[model samples]
Target: METRIFFNPGDSIANIHDYNEAVRQGQIFKRERHSDDLVIAKGPGDEEYAIFYAKDAVKNPGKGQKPYDVKNTL
Candidate 1:
């Protein structure tokens, strides 16, 4: 099964490890990859953002690897 990971800004209490752990622990919200891109819903009254990872995103997590803007094609 394909799984999708989600991270929120400033959801970490400690370092980056803790941040990821928090995400794994449900401190942040996440959902499985149901389509080409995941349509994420933000907090109440907030705008929605789509998170997507290219095929090589896992190989390269740095900039230029993932699509920052959902509307723009990667």
Candidate 2:
């Protein structure tokens, strides 16, 4: 059997085109956790969400783009 984790989504930001817009518009594309390495995925309409991997998933860095530490609270 496979295990899964659910991450909640944030409020919508209407009409974003691609990665750069995601950055310019103050979206989070990077995160640091003790275990899982996180990823940012775009939906069919270019809305972004989080996909947490049990193993490392540090794949795309948005073409030499810098990382953003999106603020969060428990």
Candidate 3:
């Protein structure tokens, strides 16, 4: 079986367990913009939802690109 996870643009980001499960299943992960006008995704990786950015996703909306804490939380 395959499962996918979705998150709204500008929402608090968290690692998806599906990513690890996909790896275990030998399935390819994917990430893309649902709508270009809504948000723009960045990064050059093979993982979907690897990194996403939105204009109003931050407090200082125009402070360049915001950084995601991609590192392990624990």
State which candidate has the highest TM-score.
2
Predicted model with the maximum lDDT = 2
lDDT of 3 by residue, 48-74 (tens): 433232333443324344433232111
- Give the per-residue lDDT digits (tens) of candidate 2, residues 1-70: 2222222233223224455554433324333233233333343333443333313222344433323222
CA displacement after TM-score superposition, residue 16 of candidate 2 (Å): 0.6
TM-score of each: 0.16, 0.25, 0.19
The local distance difference test score of model 1 is 0.29
For candidate 1, report its TM-score.
0.16
Best-to-worst lDDT order:
2, 3, 1
lDDT of 3 at 36: 23
Compare candidates 1 and 3 on lDDT and give the better one.
3
Residue 45, model 3, lDDT:
41
Which segments of model 2 are wrong by more than 4 Å? 1-10, 27-40, 44-74
